[model samples]
Target: MKNVSDEELMILVSNGNLDMMSILFDRYHVRIYNFLLKMTRDQDVSQDITQEVFYKVLKYRTSYKKGKFSSWIYTIARNVFSDHYQKQKNKDQRLNDIHYKTIGQETNSVDDEEIKEQLHLALMKLSHSDRELIIMNRYQGIKYQEIAEIMDSTEGAVKTKVHRAIHKLKEYYLQKI
Candidate 1:
């Protein structure tokens, strides 16, 4: 499992290698949880959905038949989140549910932290779709092609949407609200 690709591991899982699923879970659970946390701004809900994502992965293991394993898993996570969001439209949220840092940076400066906090606020200002694009593209480091795969769109379209989302984020950040 350590040397195997995600696709191979998932294929093994699909073929009754249930134990191998743990390796996949170990690799992905944090990422899936973080993704959901960013979307929901609720730790408890994110944890619940992250668990459900893995549960669905095992339950629908037979349905996974190829292409990028990461993409498939993200698709499932996104769908699960959508279902949950639809069911619980009035999910509780704090005014500040997240603190964001710049990509690969430790902000020790007060100025930097302030900027990052403002960026987080700006991020919250965007529509859910735009914010999702930013999170997947920038925060999670998911490439446009893979996002396109998870989003069921073309790479070019994903790139354009992400660009627009970034533009919107910039606009909101400039507002400094």
Candidate 2:
């Protein structure tokens, strides 16, 4: 099962091999959670949105196409986040309350922690789309081609967007410093 590609697992799940869904979940759940966490900056909301993403995969399993499964799953996750954002917008909820949690390392220095927190705040100050673009490219290490596919844009356009997003993030980070 570990040797099976994500696309194959998705196809099997789509074909009624329900157990394959778990495999897909195991493969992508953390990445999806981290993606959502960076976007929403809320642990609980990220968890809920991650669950919704998988539920959507199950609900729309039959619609799976033969392509990069990462792109397809990311597309679904993007849609889920958009829907959640819209609802929050209608409710007048603030989306900028990003509390940055250290994801993988323990910082030993106070200055380092402060710098990380400031950087996180700067990232949160970016527009939602820009923040997502940076997170997907920089943090999650998704390819430009796959991001373009999920975004329904040309690879060149995705590259340009990512470049601009990085520039904007840099400006913001510099301003904070």
Candidate 3:
């Protein structure tokens, strides 16, 4: 039900109330998709990964414990992204080579669109873990405590990481400008 909490819904799902899974999906699919899209920068890949994340949630339903559902789902999403990244490292390298070839020839304009584009490009240039921190804390609006739970680290550590990631993103964005 829409009035029930996410953890309660997941508990119901874990108890074999399969229809509750749809409610969970409807609640989170867009957020998860956007998170993946920000990380992958590929629409098709993000869609596939988003589907895979839900599939994983269903598959592991029995393992669901009484906790914050958001944290559990994000942990699953992060793992899925990491697995995809590992498997596609070589292909990514080739794509990066092609991307770099074209990047040099692009004009360094300072229009509104150009600034937004440069910010996006700078985000993409960040290390995967750093980018994840920024995407989670800045873009996705996840609290540091929830991020720490998902990352299996202390809240203090998450705060520090997010701070450093934002600093790096700003430096890179300024360089692009």
Candidate 4:
């Protein structure tokens, strides 16, 4: 019942420990779902992708690598999103935006809401790659190197993308006001 490292749990699962696999899913499912939810901006699509992520995990359990399981799961989610988006052939410029500000604020704050909306609008204005970079780095707190792995790019490239995306985000907010 003690806390186990992701690598250790993955090993157990690979050794055919079904219970351990369930525990692993329990530990990561919500985190992955939240990440996908934010990225997809559609609860239904997020839910479907969430299930697909787990399915991929289960299918690829034997191929699990060392380092970080988070990065591995994230990679699966990213691929799923890419494939889904491609199949849908969505060409809309608008990206889904979520209300995330005042996350813990108890009182209703109209000003905060407006600012949050503005931020969401700005995020919607970003390209999908920029949006994913910001979300993974800023929101999910994934390391740049790990993001690079999931994204199949260099850490330097990821860092540059984040920097440029932040600059654009600043420009967006400035323009909105």
Largest lDDT belongs to which candidate? 2
In what order do the candidates fall by lDDT, top score first? 2, 3, 1, 4
> Candidate 4 lDDT (Cα, whole model)?
0.81
Please, what is the whole-model Cα lDDT of each candidate in the order they appear?
0.87, 0.90, 0.88, 0.81
Over 69-173, each residue of candidate 4 has an lDDT whose tens digit, in order, gives 878889889999888876665654323423233234454888877887798778878888898899899888888999998888999999999999999988998
Q: Compare candidates 2 and 3 on TM-score and give the better one.
A: 2
lDDT by residue for model 3 (76-129), tens: 999998988877775665223323212233555657558767988888788889
TM-score, candidate 2, is: 0.93
Q: How well does candidate 1 match the true structure in TM-score terms?
A: 0.86
- Tell me, what's the RMSD of every candidate? 3.6, 1.8, 4.4, 3.4
lDDT of 1 by residue, 55-161 (tens): 99999999998779999999999999888876665565333343323345576798977987788778888987898899998989999999999999999999999
Off by over 4 Å in 4: 90-107
Give residue 98's lDDT in candidate 3 (0 to 100).
Answer: 28
Candidate 3 regions exceeding 4 Å error are 90-110
The backbone clash count of each candidate, in order, is 0, 0, 0, 0
Q: Which ranges of candidate 2 are over 4 A from the true structure? A: 97-106
Listed in order, each prediction's TM-score against the native is: 0.86, 0.93, 0.89, 0.85
- The candidate with the higher lDDT, 2 or 3, is 2
Better of 2 and 4 by lDDT: 2
